[model samples]
Target: MKHEKRWAIVSLASIPLVMTLGNSMLIPVLPTIEKKLNISSFQVSMIITLYSIVAIILIPIAGYLSDRIGRKKVIIPSLLIAGMGGIVSGWAAWKMDNPYILILIGRVLQGVGAAGAAPVVMPLVGDMFKSEKEVSKELGVIETSNTFGKVLSPILGSLLAGLVWFLPFFAIPIFCAISILLMLFLVKSPKMKKPVPFKKFFKTIKKIFKKNAKWLIAIFIIGCILMFVLFGVLFYLSTMLEDEHKIEGVKKGLILAIPLASLCIASFVTGKKIEENKVLMKWLTFIGILLSAGSVFAISFTENIYFLISIFFICGMGIGVALPCLDALITEGIEKEERGTITSIYSSMRFIGVASGPPLFVLLMKASHQVMYYTVTGICILAAIIALVGIKPKEIK
Candidate 1:
């Protein structure tokens, strides 16, 4: 990559890193918030859920706008909005006697902003690079940035919250502000052709979907499953560490980072290795899901913290290996004109997984730990089957 493109990639990569920190950083802090607000576990999970649900509803709209306008046009204002949302949540948490409802509202605003920011980066990366090889590599960097944020989130969040319970809430805006500045100063949008009319754009998207439904749906499902399992496992681990093991604060956060660190390294390596190879992408995705499923399945038999952390670390590696492949496939396979919309829809499906994961895990775990593990493992198997059967790379063109 050229020097300018390298900086652009850095700018683009910040969106995911900041966005992941804004969200996942809150995971380790959830139990803290739960106790602070005197709320139920389910209600606390809703903080994550509500943010994602709002994003899920709005992401497609953001994608359509980005397709018609430009990526930066959508992204900058979204960052501003996200930062404002953070301020709202932080203020409410710090001052209000009854802050839960207000905090949820603020998360909804953050969700609105997130709808336009991070999801748009995939297509923007696709827009920025001409070479499929470069695109795959940069997308890997983006995924690595995302997972790295996850690795940092627990420790950072815990560290911040260690000072004050609501400190993590305030930290969101600082992260967003840094990303916005990076985007403004370092990134430039590629020139786009004449915008397609709404009716024609709709028809074109329909046609693309009709033609690529099998693989598209498979990718969509697999993306959703991966997030569902990832977030579900994180929540499980977060609560388990606090309730079962009497761990909290920075210690808990450090423990949480172990699995995510493996994920970060795997994503970085896989992103570099796949390099425009659709066959490799497909097989890696398949194998990654199996690895995740196998590790999750093992959780049913063990309660040892070391064993559990080790299992989650393996699971994180599996997810890390698979995510960039999914990203590259969707970004590379789609036509540039419609890539934003298609990839945004993919992001929305992943958000659906995020929205559902924690509460569903909470419910299932209430029934039985075996039931929760088995259910997630079963979903992973189904995703693997779909990837094997539905994604015919030879037929993508």
Candidate 2:
């Protein structure tokens, strides 16, 4: 990659970092919000759920729009809308005696913004780069940047929420604004010479899926399952520490960052190595899911924090390795014109996982610990089976 291109990747990469910050940063503070707002635990989970629910519905539409118009044009305005949502939620939290419903509304707008923005980055990265090797390397960096956000979100959310229960909500616009400025001035998206027409767009998509549906559908399911497991574990761990152990604030955040750090390292390493080697990517996906399943299954054997942390870290590492391969397979497999739409569908599935994780975990926690871990492990087993059988390198690459 050229120096200019590297800078553009950095600018584009910042979008996910910012978007992750806005959403994941609030996890630690959810208990605080529950107490302050006098809402139920499920309601606190709804704060996270509604955002992804909105995004899940609109992401395909945004993907279609980006394909129709252009990436930057869609992304810039989406950032502004997301920022505006932050402002609304922040104002509601800061000023109103009862801010729960209004805050959910703000999150809905943020979800709309997220629909148009972050998912578009995958296709945009594919658009800007020409070489498969470069795209793979850069996609790894993008994934790392995202996991890094997970690493930062808890720490930052804890710090801010310590000052005020609602401080993280206020911080969203500031992060989004910075992302906006970098995107506006620093990044240069490829010009679309001829946009796809509405009538032919669905036709093209249908054809792509018809030809590649086997691997594509497998990749989508794997993506969704990994995210669902990751978020579910994180939610379970968060509530366990804060409510059960009475762990609070930055200490809790730092503890949360451990598994995320393992995940980040795995993604960064695998992203560099998996370029164009469809066979290696296939095996990695299979092996990564196996690791995740085994780790979660190990969780059923112990309640010790040290042991649990080690197991979860391994699980995170497996997921981290698996995701970039999925990204590469899908991104490299699809044409540039169709990349945005297909990748957006992939992103939407991932969001559905995120949307479903917390609430589902909350309910699952009511059961035995064995049940929770085993349920997740079962999902991982399904993902692994899909990866092994469904992903044919000859077909995808």
What's each prediction's TM-score? 0.99, 0.98
| Local lDDT at 220 for model 2 | 96
Which residue pairs of candidate 1 clash?
A: none
- C-alpha local distance difference test of each model: 0.94, 0.90
RMSD of every candidate to native, in Å, equals 0.8, 1.0
Clashing pairs in 2: none
- Runs with alpha carbons beyond 4 Å of true place in candidate 2: none
- Model 2 over residues 1-397: C-alpha lDDT tens digits? 4888888888988999988988999888888899999999899999989999999999988888888789998999999999988889889999999999999999999999999999999999999888999889899999998889998989999999999878898899998898889988888889885976777888989999999999999999999999998888888888888877788999999888889899889999999998889899999999999999999899888767788788889989999999999999999999999888899999999999999999998888788777788898899999999999899999975
For candidate 1, lDDT tens digit of each residue in 44-138? Answer: 99999999999999999999899989999999999999999999999999999999999999999999999999999999999998899989999
RMSD of 2: 1.0
Q: Compared to the true structure, candidate 1 yields what TM-score?
A: 0.99
